[model samples]
Target: MARRLFVENGFHATGIAAIAKESGVAVQQLYRDFPAKEDIIAAIVEADCERIADQNTLNTAVANKDRAGIIGWLTTTPCHKDESGDRMFLEIAAEGARNDRIRSIFQGIRDQADENISRAFAGLMDSDMVEDEHRTLAQAFMIVSFGSIFLRTLNQEPVTPASEKLITCLIESATP
Candidate 1:
């Protein structure tokens, strides 16, 4: 409810009372759960991280050292069609730019994503080590992934082909 409200009315415009009303929870209970709006965002981020981590598909591919699995995961993993969820993240991202706490939360998300991508790159290259180049490639993958989300949700543009090609090309070019 708060996520939808944040996406629809933005972070600043959506107040605690509004969130409480929308969620049918008392404002005091909401405050007990989340001290501030930023806390809500933080909880949302943590929940999202848990959800993705729970998938474990990439972890399985890496554990098995499956190049095909890694490549498939990289190319097809994160192209979500959930506009509300994407929009909510974008809202949090925008808030991140101005607020230090939010920025930290957002950076944590990016760091975790980078680590996951790096692990996948290691598996794809059949290397036990994660190198600087792997981190660099992981960063590029995040750019393509997030940029695709931005374009798809905001501009209503199709980004699957381009994103998949870029991810695949990155993997192919980086692997020996």
Candidate 2:
């Protein structure tokens, strides 16, 4: 219910009353479960992280210590296809840029993702890659993902081959 409201109205426009009505709960009950809309957003973000973490691609890459595989997992994994899903995430990110609460939530998720990538790289390379290197790769991956999202949102042409090429280059650079 909250997800539908958030997707349709955006984070800024969604009100607790609407969520309560959609959920068939009193506003007070909703507050008891989630203190604020930001709390709801955080819960959704956490759920997304959990889902991504459980993917077969990530699990296999982590088990086999495959850097390229890990990159593939991050880059090639299909995101939600529905417009509502896209809007929900994009809205959260856009709001995060201006809201400290949202920004903190995003930052936590980003930090955890970077750490996981660093661990995956360490296993693949069998060498100690510094924190800075992992951070650099994480930022690059984030930019690539966001760029793809933006292009798709704008109805631009597909860039899959180009992205794969770039990922290949990054793998080569990261390998020992």
TM-score of each: 0.93, 0.82
The CA root-mean-square deviation of candidate 1, after full C-alpha superposition on the true structure, stands at 1.4
Q: How far is candidate 2 from the true structure (C-alpha RMSD, Å)?
A: 2.8
Number of clashes in every candidate structure? 0, 0
What C-alpha lDDT, on a 0 to 100 scale, does residue 136 get in candidate 2? 77
Give lDDT: candidate 1, residue 7: 87
Task: Report every candidate's CA lDDT.
Answer: 0.84, 0.71
Off by over 4 Å in 2: 55-60, 63-72, 77-83, 128-130
Residue pairs in clash, model 2: none
For model 1, the local distance difference test gives 0.84
lDDT tens digits by residue: candidate 2, 35-140: 9999999998898777665556765777776666776665554332445555666777788999999999988877867666565555456554536776676577
Please give the TM-score that candidate 1 achieves against the real structure.
Answer: 0.93
**Highest-scoring model, TM-score:** 1
